[model samples]
Target chain A: MDTATTVLDLVGVFLNALLGGTVARRDRLDLFGFLVIGIASGLGGGLIRDVLLQHGPPAALTDPAYIPTALAGTGVAFLLDISPPDWSRAFKFLDAAALSVWASVGAQKTMGVGLGRLPAILLGTITAVGGGAIRDLLLQRVPAVLQDTRWYASVAVLVAAVEVLGIATGFPVAGTVAAITLGVLLRIVAEWRG
Target chain B: MDTATTVLDLVGVFLNALLGGTVARRDRLDLFGFLVIGIASGLGGGLIRDVLLQHGPPAALTDPAYIPTALAGTGVAFLLDISPPDWSRAFKFLDAAALSVWASVGAQKTMGVGLGRLPAILLGTITAVGGGAIRDLLLQRVPAVLQDTRWYASVAVLVAAVEVLGIATGFPVAGTVAAITLGVLLRIVAEWRG
Candidate 1:
């Protein structure tokens, strides 16, 4: 877990829980459905990553952070009843945040396991996007990446770039800053242009 | 990987694919979603069993039989434009078939791995129901288990009982016949009462 990505992942999952829960609520789902989405949206990515790595359950199951956070997020969404427009905005933020977090996490984990830079970058990309892909499949929807979403895949690349540069230069802070900056900027650019 | 459960686990996956895919089509899903449901329905129980056992992705990813059968089932449903009612009847049959499959698979896997019979039976029950539980969650519907609907869980227990009895008595064919008879009967009873 790259430090920045770790932080972002924590934040991203929390946000995902809220956003996914809100979406479930809008769909008029019952409590179990809401919690299911909240938990899934929050941890689905990591679970997919772990399963792929043959690691089993991953941090989502191993650590306690996600489940309770997601449960709380679901409760909040049910209580507050976020409107569609607001939910949409939250969704965009979540997408951007998750993209960057996944990218960095992917790269970091790949490198952590001693893979080469390129593979690390690629793994990072998959790690970041894996959860959403699983989520969409679960919901019976076309995955967002498969759809024409603006620069979705690019964020993952940018995540790798930061780490690749940092690894080359031996400046961990520089890599983190650069990667987060690139992801946030590109995401904002996509949104602003949209 | 339980020797006991392995008997029809492979066939169970294929049959459940047909069961799940038909249900998805009956629910009016498009092709891709239908395929997803088919795979989920077939693999869901086993996957759940594996995850709980910490042996994940289950046979869902590793087994050669599973993926193709699921795809074929979904393809057949789409090609035939299987009517909703006919699909529902298939669902009823599948419910019975899947339960038998899961019960044996679950008990064997759990017992093979050195777990107590109680846990094995429990795991088998979850294995039989877990996939449907997941599917319903994805569809934003209440899991039939959560409600007092039909003898869904009962079928799992019956299968487990047959398994337990066979293991106790050294009666292989008798055990299987007992399981099949119990599973099929419970399913028919559920349908008849409905």
Candidate 2:
């Protein structure tokens, strides 16, 4: 379970970093700016979650793979042109998957720390959306989650709520799976319909 | 000493909240916006620092006085018209004092937790400038500390460094006093010259 969690965490970081890198590229930012935005996008949510959890240094800082994965995502974005429509389709799916994983994991971690259900839900939502929010803030723009027509932040909130409910019903594993599945489906459907 | 620190912390929160409320007023934000900016400006830095410290929940959360103090500041700003030059002058001095207190206190708290000097300095600087940075982000503007022509972040860094040096020299009390004094003087002078 720990290993699976770690893998999912890294996957979320990488995809989010790529998304952030795309924004940096659009803004025509320099290498330094790419690194800053990419890292923040990849790790900012987890960092905020861990900090609020009163856990040790954020996993992004303490874990060896996180930073390198973020950098690798940035490198991929910097080196390759991913502006094609096909790439966008792929990115949307990947981003949805990442958000699902982060939201569930954030809720699980918060629950593990013995916090109440409300904080768990709040932190879970934050962990899913915080990176993109930070990235947007760095660009001096309103975060998409705050104004997105698609079910972005809403998907995260629902996923967190599902996870919290699952835990309450003593079906942690099933809850995670269900939450992720629901989140991915909702997000993709929202995007497609929009 | 504890009582003094608490007093200083509350004072900083009130002043920073007022500062944030002033900005919200200028932006013609609603009451909700004023409260959001005010609480964020007052407590955001300390919250960030505490989270990084891996301490228990942030003092701002655990302490009863903080949120009310912040709200009070916001209320004052909402009620009064303090757009005159005289009020601005008084605000400048109070703001300077608050900055100094927060910077030194942040460094001191970091050191008290048995962390190294570098973290101490980093956290200290964050604690001083983080609130305004967050307020700006919420407003979708670039943070002043990041781009201010005035030596705002620089002053925080210097104050933190001074605190770190004082601790290293086994003069913690003297360090806090000197750091605050230097910070206040430098900030006032910078504002005056500007």
Each prediction's whole-model lDDT (CA):
0.69, 0.84
Model 2: fraction of the reference interface contacts it also forms: 0.30
Which stretches in model 2 have alpha-carbon errors above 4 Å? A88-90, B1-43, B52-54, B59-133, B142-194
Residues A115-158, model 1: lDDT tens digits: 67887777777776665565565555677878647777767777
Give the per-residue Cα lDDT of candidate 1 at A80. Answer: 89
Candidate 2 C-alpha lDDT tens digits along A57-131: 787888899999999998887877665254667678778888999999999988887776766776788899889
The C-alpha stretches of model 1 lying farther than 4 A from their native spots are A2-7, A87-98, B1-41, B47-194
Clashing pairs in 1: A45-A131, A102-A128, A106-A124, A107-A124
lDDT of each residue in B15-131, candidate 2, tens digit only: 888878888888777665676678789989998898778779677755668778888888888788555244676677777778877888889899899999999999999999999
Q: TM-scores across all candidates?
A: 0.60, 0.62
Chain A TM-score per candidate? 0.83, 0.95
Q: Best candidate, TM-score-wise?
A: 2
Model 2 chain B lDDT-worst window of ten = B81-90
